[model samples]
Target: MRKLLLRSFYRIYQSVFKMAMPFLPWRRPVLLEGAGSIKKLPGLLEELKIKNVLIVTDSTLMKLGLLDNLIKELGINGCKYAIYDQTVPDPTIENVEEALKLYHKHNCKAIIAFGGGSPMDCAKIVGARVSRPKMPIEKMKGVLKVIFKIPTLIAVPTTAGTGSEVTLAAVISNSVTHEKYPINDFCLIPHYAVHDPELTLKLPSHITSMTGMDAMTHAVEAYIGRSNTKETKKAALEAIALIHQNLLKAYTTPGDIQARAAMLKASYLAGVAFTRAYVGYVHAIAHTIGGFYGIPHGLANAIIMPHVLEYYGSAANGKLAELADHLGIGKGSQSTDQKANAFIQYLKEMNQKMNIQSNIEQIEEKDMPEMISRALAEANPLYPVPRVLFEEELKELYYKIKG
Candidate 1:
C-alpha cells in the first residue's frame, strides 16, 4: 500500500514537471566547437571583459600540463586567473568551498571548469556558492534551489564523457556522511561550453571506455524515462547513435581526433537530454556506490546500468527494443523482449572487450543497506524511472552487482 502511494505521488510530480517544462527557464550554453576551440576561449573572456577568472581542475590535469596552452592564452589575452586544482573524483562540498575561496580572493568575474566532471561539478557549486553566499550547500540538494544567477561559468571538458559542460546538475559528495547528491537548477548551467577534441586525444583507453559508457548510460536513461520532451528524445537518440559508432574507435585509437570529436558531441547531446528529461536508476545507484566506495562515476555506471535495465524487465522492454532497433542490434523477427535482452547483452560485451569489470569489487556487503537507502532517496519521486523500485527490489539489484 505504501509503495503504491509513493508510486502515485511520483507519477503526479512527474506529470506536473512535464506540464511546467515548457514555461521553465531553459537555456543552452553558447557553444565553441572543433579542434582549436579551447584557444578561442581567452578571446571570449577578453570580449566579455573578464579580467579575473578562477580555473577549477584536478591535480592529474596539472601533472599532465594540460592547462599550459589555455593558461598561456589567458595571459596573452590579459585575463588574470587563479587556479584551484584540488578537486577530486566525486567532488566534495569542501572542494566547492576551497574553490570558492580562490574565486573570491582573485575577485573572479567568471569561472573556467577545465578538466572532467569533477572539476566541472566543483566549479558549478562554487558559482552557486558565489551566487548564494548565505545558503549552505546542503540546502541546495534538490531541484531549483539555486534560482539566483551564478557568475559566468565556462565549461572546458577535457574528457569525452560526463557532459558536465552542458549540464545544469552538479553532483557533490558529503565527506563526513559519505553521501552523494545532485543540486539541480537552471542557474547552474554554464554560460559557455568549449569542446576541443584535441584535449581528449591522449585519454587513456580505460578512461575513454568508461566515459564513453557513461555517455551511453545518460542517453539510455534519458530516452527510457517517462518525462521526455520531443527535443530531449531527439538529442538522446543522436547521442546514442554517435556513441555506438565512435566509442569503440576512440577507445582503440586514442589519437583518432574524429572519433574523439564525435564522442564529445555525443556527450554534450546526452547532457542536454538528461538535464531536462532527467536520468534514472543508473545514475541514482552509481552516485551511492561512488560515494560509499570511492568508485569512479563512469565505471560504476558502466557496471550497474545493465543490472538495473535488466531488472526493469517488461517495464523497459518497448523503449529498450526501440533502441536496439535504432542500433540495428537484433533481427527484425525478434520479439521486443529479445531485442531488449540483446541491447543489454551488447553493453555487457562492450564492457568485457574494454576490460571493464562486470562487478564493482569495491562494493561491500556491509554497505548494501545504506547504499540502497541512499539510492532510493535519490530516485523516488524525482527521477521518473520506467519502473519504481522499493527496498526489496533495489536490494536484489545490489546483490546482483556485488563482487
Candidate 2:
C-alpha cells in the first residue's frame, strides 16, 4: 500500500511536469561546428566585446598543451584570459569554488569550458555561483533553481562524449558527503558550443570507448523514458543511429576524423535529448556510484545501464525492441523479448570488444546501502523512468554490478 501510494504520487508529479514541458524556456546554444571550429571562438569573443575570460579545464588537457591554439588565438584577438585547470573527474564543489575564485580575481566577463564533461560541469556551476553569490551551491541543487542569468559561457569539448556543450545540467559532487547531483536550469546552457574534431584526434582508445558508450546511454535513456517531446525523440533517434554507425569506427581507428566528427555530433544531439527529456535510473545509480567511489561517470554508466535495462524487463520491451529494429539487430519474425535481449547482448558485446569491464570492481559491499539511498533519492519524483524500483530492487542491482 505504501509503495502503491508513492508510485502514484510519482506518476502524478511526472504527468504534471510533462504537461508543463512545452512551456519551459528551452534554448539551444549557438553552434560552431566542423574542423577548425575552435578557431572561431576568439572572433565570437571579440564580437561579444568580452575582453577577459576564464578557461576551466582539467590539468591533463593543460599538460598536453591542448589549449595552446585557443590560448594563442585569444591573445592575438586582444582578449585576456585566466586558466583554471584543476577540474577533476566528477567535478567537486571545491572545483567550482576554486574556478569561481579565478573568475572573480580576473574580473572575467565570460567563461570558456574547455575539455570534457568535468571541465564543462565545473564551468557551468562557476557561472551559477557568480550569478547567485548569496545562494549556496546546495540551494541550487534541483531543476530551475538557478533563475538568474549566468555569464557569457562558451563550451569547447575536447572529447566526443559527455555532450556538456549543449546541456543545461551541471553535475557536481560533494566530496565530503559522497553525494553527486545535477543542477539544471535553462540559464546554465552555454551561449556557444565550439565543436572541433581536431581536439578529439589525440584521445586514447579507452577514453573514446567510455565516452562513446556514455553518449549511447544518454540517447537510450531519453528514448525509453516517458517525458520525451517530439523534438527530443527525434534527436534521440538520430543520436542513436550516429553512435551505432560511428562509435566502433572511432574506437578502432582513433585518428579517423570523420568518425570522430560524427561521434561528436551524436554526443551533442544526445545532450539535447536528455537535457529536456531527462535520464533514468542508470544515470541516478551511476551518479551515486561516481560520487561514492569516485568512479569515472562514463564507465559507471556503461556497466550499470545493461543491468538497469534488464531489470526493467517487460516495461522496457517495446522501446528496446524499437531500438533493436533501428539498429538492424533482430529478424522481423523475432518476438519483442528476443529482439530486446538481442539489443542488450549487442551492448554487452560492444563493451567486451572495447575492453570495458562488465562489472565495476570499485563497488564495495558496505557502500551499497548509502549508494542505493542516494540513487533512489535522485530518481524518484524527478526522473520519468519507464519502470521505477524502490529499495529491494535497487539493492539487487547494486549487488549485481558489485565486483
Best by lDDT: 1
lDDT of 1 by residue, 1-403 (tens): 9878989999999989988989999889999999988899999998998899999999999999889999999889888999999999999999999999989988999999999999999999999999999999999998999899999999999998899888889999999999999999999999999999999987899999989999999999999999999999999999999999999999988999999999999999999999989999999999999998899999999999999999999999999999999999978999999999999999999999899998876678788899999999899889989999989998888888884
lDDT of 2 at 81: 96
lDDT (10s digit) by residue, model 2, range 1-403: 9999999999999999899988988788899989999989999998999999999999999888889999999999999999999999999999998899999999999999999999999999999999999999999998889989999999999887798889899999999998999999999999999989999999989899999999999999999999998999999999999999999999999889999999999999999999988899999999998998888899888999898999899999899999999989988999999999999999999899999998887788898889888888889988999997999999998888874
Candidate 2 local Cα displacement, residue 161, angstroms: 1.5
Cα lDDT, all candidates: 0.93, 0.92
For all predicted structures, in order, the TM-scores are 0.99, 0.99
Prediction 2 TM-score vs. true: 0.99
lDDT of model number 2: 0.92
Q: Give Cα distance to truth, residue 218, candidate 1, Å.
A: 0.3
Candidate 2 regions exceeding 4 Å error are none
Task: Count clashing residue pairs per candidate.
Answer: 0, 0
